[model samples]
Target: MTECDINNQTISRPGNSWLAAAVWNNSYTYKVSAHCPLHYCLPYSTHLNFSIPNSQCQFKRAGILCGHCQQGLSTIFGSSNCQKCLNIYLFLIVPIAISGIILVLLLFILNLTVTDGTINAFILYVNIISINTPVFFPQLGKFTPAYTFISLVNLDLCIQTCVYNRDDYAKMWLQLAFPFNLIFIATSLIITSRYSTTIQRLTARRALPVLATLFLLSYTKILLIVSSVLFFYSKIFHLPGDHTELVWSVDANVPLFGVKFITLLIACFIIFLILVPFNIILLFTRWLSRFTLINKFKPLIDAYQGPYKDKMYYWVGLQLVLRVVLFAVSSLDRNNNVIIGIVLFILVIGLHGTTLRPFKNEIKNYQEKIFIMNILILFALALYNHGTTNMTAVNVMIGLAMGHFILIVIYHIFTYALSGVTRNKLQLHINTLVGWIIRLLNKNPVHQSRLDSHVMNKIPTAVNYHEYREPLVVQD
Candidate 1:
């Protein structure tokens, strides 16, 4: 053991593994030790000399040990192997850590419809719309396939930029996310198909449950669309890397059979596979209507008639096409071109929605129009701020977009709150309050007396009652 003395306090170095200090304050002494083992490093080093031992290390109280402390410990122990072992451990650990997180999230999303059947259609639609928005705006020049994948979870895996390469990490995430999203999409489709009859029955009995299931199915479909689009985009616009080595690239065709192949498959699946049941029902009902044997089941066929009649599958397919177009335009790597493409797409969809009104609910049709208008204005601002160097204008546009998003969210929430009995009751209360106020205001003594006098002045004094009475008696 070695001893050092400072401020009448004794500091002791016990063995090669630990440094201990006795601190004196208010006639009390407390011992604090830095257990700097040869294999493990403590972030903070204890100053052995001071009465109150101060920490001399720069690292904050984050869980991981700092490099300086590790190097210091390794130097004191005369061993260079500690850093190598730590690096190997971290190399093995990071992927496992991120994979665990992804698995948890995947499980949660997969179970969302099953565990919670009360999800609101309006809120679900708003979420789908918001999340499906381009994570990287081309005008901002931050467009990267890595960013698109990272934005899915919105997690900051690396706090320090130098710790890990972001592009590589994004590639890892893409590999993990692709498979998980595929599983989610497949499971969701199967579950929805299995419950199709149940949903139809629920439709005739309880509307809310049916709407929730339908919205959930739509959400899964949208998720599939988003995943497929990103996968396709990544294949088309590759980063400066060996494409043959990357798992998500078209050249690295292994599990996906190729990114382009999978994308085409998904597109066809979205356009046709999901519509198979509806087509079957339509064809079956048409064939049955010809034979009088199934005339009694006409009512049953009518229950599933709305979607086919509205040609809503075509509308959905159009949506997927438009999304693909938007992403393709964004890949052109030109800000103004992207903005113009967005504007044109919005115009086309706005026109289509306005004229066709795919939704059965009139409110939803109007809501879609309002949402399109807001998005159009936001993109217009982006276009105006395209070539400008003014930070203020850019910030203002971003703020305006955020404000519009908030307003749309609030509108959806307000609409959801004012539905069914709630809206009716609120209306009744408002009408009652207004009627009460009017009656109270009309109860003014001066006004009432004035009205009575005005009526008195307009009345005849006498004589007319006799002629009126005679006519009434002779009418028989």
Candidate 2:
């Protein structure tokens, strides 16, 4: 709870996990770089200089950061006046958790059911160019390929025609993969860095959900990598079964099995490369924080602290090392998939970002960022499929997904830009604007006046009035 002066003088506090940020002036405004809990420990190389919190309640109020509060508040009010805190979990987090589970399940089910030719085509979805002709694609007439889809009313699955069954559409998806993955990776790295910073500042009580989300993402990616490797590596097994027409099975003994294997290995490697160095730096920083005082490193650390060049070198170098390691390890996949497993672990680590935060801010954690990213990425994929194919089902999905994507993107981007001095004002404004959308989706829209009146009643006179706005709180 101690605040530093504007003079930049060192004011060290002992055994204080509560105050990680250095404040200038009495207002508790924080230095962005000094916001991580381990500000006293090691320097953060991957943290983003996004808007920092400016109030005491930010650090004190239920341990939620300004950003996450906005989201939770949306959920709270998304129902009716957000009558209880549980609504926050129900309205916001549950849907995302469910989506992630469904996504993982879909990946596995699709992998298991798709024909070997289809699996080969799926792997080729990232290839720069297509080699397969229409004949290679397993389709009935032209665009529609066959799959078993459940009929909602009958609760029965019947073989139906879908664009995903088309080999050409799969190839088209790969054409878009470069930009899609590029955007996804870039955005994911940024969010992961943000999550790292948030986790550091979070109290044990506040961090439970964030930690769980991180673990979930990690587990999901592990499953994805394992499933990916299994599907691709199966070419080597040459298992006797009903299916033996896989052209991918041609290279069973090669180091990575085939081009697709190399491609996936490289993809996983790239993610691991991003994760390793950042986490290493975090470990080093934490270890150093406990031993070194400001006075000891001030003179030396100050030299690199002002300019961004050397730091950039460290940052950029670490990123390049990811690429280097990926290619390096891909050359030697020895020891019974151990290397693959190790890389898979690294990919999961890399996909998740750095761990450090000054004010246990839930503003944007791994889950929110990853959830948004996946949705957007899916939009890009769905859009591509819709455009390339003539199937009615693909077009219908695209129609729905694109519309949802556009609405969510617009609503989120617009409201996220709105910040207020008081959590009440911020949440109220945010909840009022975004809450309706949430309700609409949940199919339980309350009258606007009712919600406003309810929210007004919940906020005491001292807390709600704009004239007596709450000061922003940033915790460490």
The C-alpha stretches of model 1 lying farther than 4 A from their native spots are 1-309, 333-336, 387-476
For model 2, the run of ten residues with the poorest summed lDDT = 126-135
Worst 10 residues of 1 by lDDT: 75-84
At residue 449, give the lDDT of candidate 1.
Answer: 88
Candidate 1, residue 97: CA error in Å?
10
CA lDDT, every model vs. true structure: 0.40, 0.31
**Count of backbone collisions within predicted model 1:** 0
Using alpha carbons, what is the TM-score of model 1? Answer: 0.35
lDDT of 1 by residue, 1-476 (tens): 34556665655434212332333453433322222322222333333443322232222211111113232222111111122122233353466456644543332333222112222222333333233233223222232333233233222221122222222212333433433443454445445645698643422333322322333334333443445334432222122333222233211222356664565446546645544444344445555467775566454344334332345424443443444455445434434544655667576566757667756656555655555554455455556655343344434444543454456446545764586566899999999999998798779999888888999999978876675555534554
lDDT (10s digit) by residue, model 2, range 1-476: 33444454433322312122333555343322112221111221222222232222221121211112223332121011111133223243344345444533332222211111111111111110011111112132233221121111011112222212112112223322322332343235445655687533322122222222222223222322333343332211111223222212112223444665567556656655644543344224334445555336433222222222222313222322433343234323322222332343344335435442111223323323333233233334334453233346433443443444345445434543452234468778788889888777556455666777888999766655765866687567
